[model samples]
Target: MNITLLEAELRRDEGTKYSPYIDSTGNQTIGVGRNMKANPIPKDWTFPLTDAQVNQLLAEDIQTACASLDRFLPWATAR
Candidate 1:
């Protein structure tokens, strides 16, 4: 899979963000609208992530998404 393309699409669709914010449904979200419920932060995690941290979070989210896709569509790995 083209992770660069996937990241581009995610940024285009979800919109990149550096600071933590409450989403429409009131979930604490950050780094391209990553839902805290689905991707929990460390117990000591803080708000207002730096640019590097935001990028790291986006990378982690991308990995998680890819894993999910692989699990649901095993044939994707054969491509």
Candidate 2:
């Protein structure tokens, strides 16, 4: 997963149905329904990064994710 290609976004999802929650000690049940929609990513993001630069950024982002996810990846796959 390229970090550059992927932007960190906080998405608000709307709940389908009402869900009741039991508080600690079972004093009272609370119903919380409907989740707010996730905000869209900011547009007009400027960058000096090119496609190549973005790819590199993504590879770097995954360095800790799986150890060697980027090791086999290059600009093009060798036959």
Candidate 3:
């Protein structure tokens, strides 16, 4: 899969938000659909995040999600 394309799509769909806000699902979210309630990184994330920080978080989240998919469905990425 093209990660660059995926990131672009996510940014368009999720829309970047520097400040934390409640998501439609009621989860604490910020920075390209990051669910703070699930994985609250960048400790003491109360302050508005910078673009670099948000981008970093998005990369991490994507990595984690991909790892999870690989673990659960090893054949998925085998091609």
Candidate 4:
């Protein structure tokens, strides 16, 4: 599976949000449906990140997700 394609699908499905909101399970989330509980912010992190910051976080989160996929489905990355 292509990581870029996977990321695009995730972005399309999850959508993007600049502001934080509570997810269905009562977890705080921000930036492309990232769960705060799963992806905790730094202790010194602040709320209301700028659009660029939000994009940066989304990119980071996507990378994290791809890493997890690689770990769980090593064959997915095989040619």
lDDT of 3 by residue, 8-61 (tens): 999999999999899999999999999988988667665688788999999999
In terms of lDDT, the best-performing candidate is 3
In candidate 1, clashing pairs total 0
User: After superposition, which runs of candidate 1 have C-alpha atoms over 4 Å from their true positions?
Assistant: none
Q: Model 2 residue 79 lDDT?
A: 34
Model 2's TM-score against the true structure: 0.25
TM-score of every candidate: 0.78, 0.25, 0.91, 0.72
Instruction: Give per-residue CA lDDT, model 4, range 1-79, as digits (tens).
Output: 5657866787799877777899778988887788888887566667776677767777888787668868998786666
Which consecutive 10 residues in model 3 have the weakest lDDT in total? 41-50
lDDT pick, better of 1 and 3: 3
Best by TM-score: 3
Off by over 4 Å in 3: 44-46
Candidate 3 accuracy as lDDT: 0.90
lDDT of 1 at 50: 74
Clashing residue pairs in candidate 3 are: none
Pairs of residues at least 3 apart in sequence or in different chains that clash in candidate 1: none
Number of clashing pairs per prediction, in order: 0, 5, 0, 0
